[model samples]
Target: MPSSVTWGLLLLAGLCCLAPATLDEDAIQSASHKFMLNLADTAFSLYHQLVGPSNTTNIFFSPVSIATAFAMLSLGAEGTTRTELLEGLHLYWKEVPEAAIYTGLLNLLHTINEPDSEPWLITGNILFANLSVKFKDEFLKYVWELRHSDVFCLRFRDAKARSKVNDFIEMKIQEQDLDLFEEFDKDTTLVLVDYIVFEGLLEVKFEAETYVSEAFHVDKKTMKRIFMFRRSGQFELLHDEALSSWVLLQHYRGLGPTFLILPDAGKMQHLEAEVSQEHLTRIFHSMAARSASVYLPKVYISGTYDLKATLGGMGITKVFNDGAELSGISEGQPLKLSKALHEARLIIDEIVMDRSGARPSGKHRSNLLTVKFNRPFLVILMDKNFNIPLFLGKMVKPW
Candidate 1:
């Protein structure tokens, strides 16, 4: 009943389990491989059900899940088989509504390798450089500015007011890239809107003013003020109460089309983890326009443990403060659950290393582990590299 003894027993069981795995032709059909197969089936099934078959909405799907799934399939299938499975997934990708998802999947596919009767480890580099050309072309553009303008308006009859108007026009021009936008004159009665872009088809709007929130500043006791100025340094009017403050600009630049002002690249990083429906819209729009790479990294680990006792003969202690329940189990529920728990622990601890390319593009990778637990539970998301969380609950709940 000591924890150390339990760990020793678990380690013995794991070694025994691994001993029978040979590289023979029938190796894949062994009982040890069932968990991986089930993982693949369940993961793809969940994705299919939740995401449907639309390329448009595909980018919104979790990048972690997509990359991990391919990595898992790569481990189990060979050259032709791997190609078939990858192509099969591509077939499904075509139905994705979100183009970024399509591109991102392609990025994921480039990370996997076919089994060669030896361990298949993917290096996570995308070989198809040309595959991104179209996406890139769609993102950047060139255009001619037919005319330029500046705000000559006056407020409170002060130089600062006049200066503010100038700053506004400059920021707007860069933010919106309008063919025609400027302040009329120093005596003009009109006030300028901060930063915004509006075309017949595309429109991006930002707050007229920035907030000086105590929480937002490094010095909580003080506030920070951010003013929207045109690229030319002209000032715009103020907006202090807006919830969202970033937008995009689109137009034609001579023979090629161009994207005007983009959301701050820093702000864009926040969008990567957002799973809302609206987040998908922005993600695809950016993907189509800029062809930016969204880098995602997933880590997992492996080890064996004994449920009843550790290798040092100490009794197993509950990992958390909450009391554990171990009433009745039909078979080896504790051992199986323990394995799942160990792998889960490895993932949460970031024990695995990320092996994607040097470029920060949305490249992702994962590690797999065979483990046994000192508790009872079911293994979820292992097939998908357990990138996504298995349960949904409070932000911080009982582990």
Candidate 2:
């Protein structure tokens, strides 16, 4: 565990070395083959916690079935036959659609909290980076083949059609816009990149250029509510001083909240506005404290370039120093910083999967009958220690 900045720097260094080999078009296919193998290995370990060592025979069945069932089992699904049979089914399906292999696997495994028991030391040096680059290129080739060519796409697309009934059930979350979800439901089988979870909160960050800029243009207030599920379940009114605009909103769970490192007041001019380092330190301390409460609850985390415990149970763990000194805050400002931090925590608590909903957050829906596949026997997770993007990319259930 390191500071977010520390991990960012490490990942950057790793990327620089890996860039060259991946850039070459010829090397991609081989890279993907290797990447998938590694991904499967990691996924297996992750599901071990969710579906015990003795039970994990196949990567897609038993464990997946359990997780998809929302941690409970129906009468017929209780015995070893049901578990092992499901495991065998997943193993059969594992080799068919290759591009989806990595992402699907990761989501399945992560849902089970696979730990990195066998930590692979990723030396971000030239040689190691080049090796990763080679695999990354191959992985990209497999991904492209599935996405672009109609032949593979059509066959898998139908196979996926058979799979979506279960896929949709796993991805359905609370507070989701029913209208939008309904519209997409008919076609909600796995796509190249349908979002499942957004780290820990209701926020989503699409890949660069994934959608046209014009495709999304909500006001700041709405934008905040839309992505601040972990921060606040309720909506808010925000004033966009920069554009002299105002708007209304709604938020979701598991997405990170909006944190303003520096405030921007475009229109209303203030002569000398500043938050001294002392105040900043106090704010940081408050956050750190909330993060360290005795009752460690699940919270969503934002930002792209950091290594969270790739696999483990949910809770907060401090990294780096126990404490640091504060420098510039005036006496009154300390109390103000404390208040801000508390507000932020309260906002976050509101959106976590709690008893606030009539239906329990992580449990399956029973009132409305729906078809679900033999519990995904095992989850297939990706190993992105060498390539960070692959890890993050595969973390969600993408349909």
Candidate 3:
């Protein structure tokens, strides 16, 4: 039985939300690749800001989706309005041409979201606009070309409009718990909504017989009984000296690799502080295979973020302020982003699929190192192709 574990799950959904291929400036060439770098930059920054220095709330959301959705807005943004939005998203610092950023976003979306690929990660963008305003035909056309989304013109306060929006989201993600829109403001001319739902189904999952419903240590004194799934095999392992944590790498079927970092006792804060792109890449390259037993607590995380405050902290302000510039969306009226809402959830448990031969139930050997996530740890998840963070959070309790 393990005690008090504070874990952070950094899931970077590759709806193009994963980190870029490399953080090294020398490795960057085209703007398309730079798009990924920018995504990683924003992803890490946003996750850090949301979690703060001393906060440990389980946070989950997509940075790629946010950056891409706002990139669309940047198309219509003029002057400082556009500058602030791009800077906040970490999309402007590279001096990459604005058009190239849009192209990179479109390319990343297509790269991860091929028509023939499995739908492990599903995402969408929908614009709810006041019926009175008319978006220019060109803007709508480009949105379709860039975002693969459609716009709906309806009254902001209309209950039916909210229901329709929610209904569409539920249909896309197949999760009933998320699609909830209570009321739209009367002055709400445009509401950009983004949602992503990912269920990681690893190629190899722990069998039912091995699962133990045991008491877990949430802290020094609190104990809670939870289903701790156990597996034994050759897992890629890394002992990061700088962070004082052991990094475990696991693979998802069609998604990407997940890095679970178990910090030394009383080292969770130090690990959070030392998190960076360099450490991530170093771990990916340095982790080596080793025989060990791994224990994972079944986890489910969900949260909603007000992008206004989050992006504001990231240096993206004008769009949400009074003197905003969003006329590009619709010259039909003065447009400023009134609300940028996003939500996401992740569930990790035994997802049993049909198997052929005998499962890899390791032989009881004396040398087998046992790694129980019975204490505080961190989970860094990124989509396979995109290499960005899918879901990010710290959970003392996963419900």
Candidate 4:
């Protein structure tokens, strides 16, 4: 179909960097680590935007996916547009120059996606341009050099285009639940689709048989029943006085701890206001190993965001407007980002991840050190080594 929209640069933002060759390995690693930290902070801020004071909304997203996607788009952006984009990503404040951030992101992504890395986690981007629009060879070359991925310019003849794309994603995710067709509009000429699949393996398993129906608090008065998975073992636990929330760290074999924060009754607002990067870092450092019987719901939560407004809020408005300078993408045509869509799905399964890594917790042992995520809770999946959040989630009710 003929459309005004054209091609897009939807590569992972940090997948490649416009880097100078003078830096040593140490410098690159340091820059990448700092970039990840800043990205984590952006994750928290974006989460806060989706979820307000109530903390009653369920949200799941790959902050890295969103950050890198924008980074890719920034390659084509110029003038104030590029500046605003970097600022939104907190790419400016990290002491490292913007080049370093991109360079570091390249290393960071490469390290995490090494061949030895487990299959449970996957993230990739595909930039699709309809056959009619001509993209710059230099742009594609730069993208290929950086992302090490191919961009396809296909003939969008029918719905099959959507089906083909969805099939690729489903195969990668190993699940067919999400439908990406709904996310795209007919006017979209150039599209960049990003996805993340994370199947977290628990270092210690919660027996599936122990799962029992329990009350999950949606609010003070509203409650719902959920098949809560029960386990009792040594876990890193903490009580944050600042947020008045009981923070529990459940370690996933190699993925790191999924921080489950359950706010005290009517304390959700306070938790939202007080939560920050420093606070979370301090909390992680202070957490001590304690034996407790923990309960968590099997949650299937997904978040779909139209990020134009969100990015605009962060001073990235010029790229979406008419005066956008995307000549870096296409020479003769003026490219405008008609839509910026992000979709993330997170499933906290009740069943043990795999046969080898985990064993069922035989039965629930009665103990004073007990914690139940029966209320609205926050789930932050982070990489302990990099201090980066892989998936940030809030489960108001798990079904």
Candidate 5:
């Protein structure tokens, strides 16, 4: 079994928060799409900064989760701190009112996380504050009503407080064990955590017998043995001349399709350097459905990341320092973000044969072409309608 990779988004103190007020559904959707695009751009930019060109490690994180947490934290931000957060998130205060943005985010979250929604997705937010700190009634009310997050009070210095926080995270994610925090000191005042979990089954299940241990080329000189899933069908394929990459779209039962980008041999670095949300938007819009045989590895990635440096690099400073202003949250006791921690686990596996044991027929045998991801590739899980990235990652070395 390959070791699971952990992806984390940690924002230490003074971020943003979101909520829903009164707004038209259509207008809210439109506004939310715009917001998601900007957020996606910021997410990709942060990812690139965290995983520089020299690293070959597998990368994964939920942009929506991190953005949701920031949106919530933004509620308490004021002055230049607030401006930096809004600009950093690609939010133009002049164009869209802050209330509308919050409303849009809430509607978007509700739509994606609806109980009956396909491709099971779970998203949640929580805030743990020191017991001594008195959060303002307005801030608490908005966080609960708009963001749908729960607030808990904990003694930061308690030895058992760390275990309690960890327990809450585990329960929320349905995982048995998770160490969300190692230690809490006197300086630790507030902790904010967000998570997103997706379990998607391919619309067309892959046959179990076709699975095989294949050689996955980590690079030109290195290869690792990994299990790969094989299937042949009509798919939306694009040979992006601009990016010098082959883009493939694989549909899940519900929600948006997963995009897999395979750059030409030895061109991964160049593509990564040039890739952006605008470029991806063009490629996805240009894709046309065609018959092809697709081979992708069975991927399971679990990653943990500290996003302090990444957020700071993106010009979101001041929030971590003592001069930070979060008066909207508390009355008098000055509070700065003490810690931001995020942990996520994602498993991408093919759905086994049904009870009838049906197999793929020779439906598209006439124009069958082969497209295999035998090397490092990039994956983006997104909402088809809004083009919002639920999860973004790069698979370099599977292990």
Candidate 6:
């Protein structure tokens, strides 16, 4: 016979496999989409707050990964800590049951993990706890069922233990070569690590022969050289006078599409001020498909953020303090989140094809209008069906 802790972990893993299959497909998707949108809104709000007044630096992050970590942590919270976690995530627990939220998240993981899905998305979550402290069975069950996260019990003070945790994360996202954590504090009681790695090819790829090194304006006076990709096709375009930006939608092989927002001269700040869930949804719906010649630079952007201050700014203060009410995780031991670290990287490259085939006639190219991204712009990689933004950021400088 196994110990109660071992039995609990086994049950948790079993439940994860069974939960999504039992729920109604449509209801699960609907609730999952709503929850993800709410989380994305909160994540973007946090981004704007972190970037501050100086918006010159490039920014990139995985909001879905951050939100998923918090959702898992919320399961062990009690009283004020629980309330703050839920509200901070823009999730209303009263209207949505805890089971539903977990089930919905499971459904989303299933969709993205499908064998045939393009723009392959892979996510991993882990909870590292002190060896002396024992986690409650209920809390472990929720983490496993909701996020399919791996739970590890290790001595934080031990150097080998920290290396083991880092090794596991590296192996999970090895295709992208991401290292999520550099070191763990010896005094740390618990830490949550979440990451997302996405790689996709454009449905209509750029021709390598046409690739040109062009000038990318960092600002009015500064410029940098970058390889620009060109493609001529019908894309959904929106010229929003209110926001003073041009919205262009580009589809990958998968379900979600990436939206590029190029602000008119001197209007970047104005458009950033008006960003919100409602505003993004409105902009997406207002777009109409049109023929255009698009030129965008190939980019590889990566960022690491220590989110403790940002979470505090969003009214999630209690979880990081010593007196935090996390009784659900352990009754006798007082545990609070000591560190919240997030690191994300995105690689956008063209899928160069063989040019042996005949090219389009000259007449075909005459009707296409030109749209060039020579200045700074915002990119939103979102799931079209759910209005969920998997990744969001701005490219201010290529380097």
| Candidate 3 local lDDT, 1-399, one digit each (tens) | 110000001111122332454222223326556667657778888887777544435677777778888887777777898888777888875555443465566667776566666536677788877887778765676677766776877777776877877786677678775657777777787788777767777667655326667766656676678777766667788678998988888777666778788888778878878887678887898778987777777767766787888888878888876678766667656777878888776767544432453445446734578777776466667757667775565656754
Q: Give the Å shift of residue 99 in candidate 5.
A: 2.5
| Residues 89-198, model 4: lDDT tens digits | 77766567455566656666665566776536667766777666677775676565455544766655556777776776577656775676654456555666667767
Model 3 spans > 4 angstroms off: 1-29, 53-56, 159-161, 177-179, 207-209, 349-367
lDDT of 2 by residue, 115-139 (tens): 4422221111000011111222322
The all-Cα superposition gives candidate 6 an RMSD in Å to the true structure of 5.1
Model 5 earns a TM-score of 0.84
lDDT of 6 by residue, 24-125 (tens): 445644665566657777767767766776667888887767776786676677778877876886765576544455555556566666777777667777
lDDT of 1 by residue, 1-399 (tens): 222122223332343343343212233223223322233332333333433233222111222333333322222223343333344333223322221222233333222222331222212211111111121111111000001112232342454543454444434434233222222333232221212111111122211122121111212243333321111111121111111212222221111111111122233223222223233234324433222211111112222112112211221233111222211111222210111010012222211222332323223212211111111111121112212222111100102
Of the two candidates 1 and 5, the one with more favorable TM-score, higher being better, is 5
Candidate 6 lDDT trough over 10 residues, lowest sum: 1-10
User: Candidate 4 regions off by >4 Å?
Assistant: 1-29, 52-56, 93-95, 148-150, 154-174, 183-187, 350-367
Model 2 / residue 137 / CA error / Å: 16
Can you tell me which runs of candidate 2 are displaced by over 4 Å?
1-190, 196-258, 267-347, 350-399
- Per-model TM-score, in order, reads 0.18, 0.19, 0.83, 0.83, 0.84, 0.83
Decoy 1 TM-score against native: 0.18
lDDT of 5 by residue, 152-250 (tens): 899989989999999988888888867867888878888877777777778876554366678989887788888877666567887787778889877
lDDT of 1 at 239: 13
What are the RMSD figures for all models against the true structure?
Answer: 29.2, 26.0, 9.6, 6.0, 8.0, 5.1
RMSD of 2: 26.0
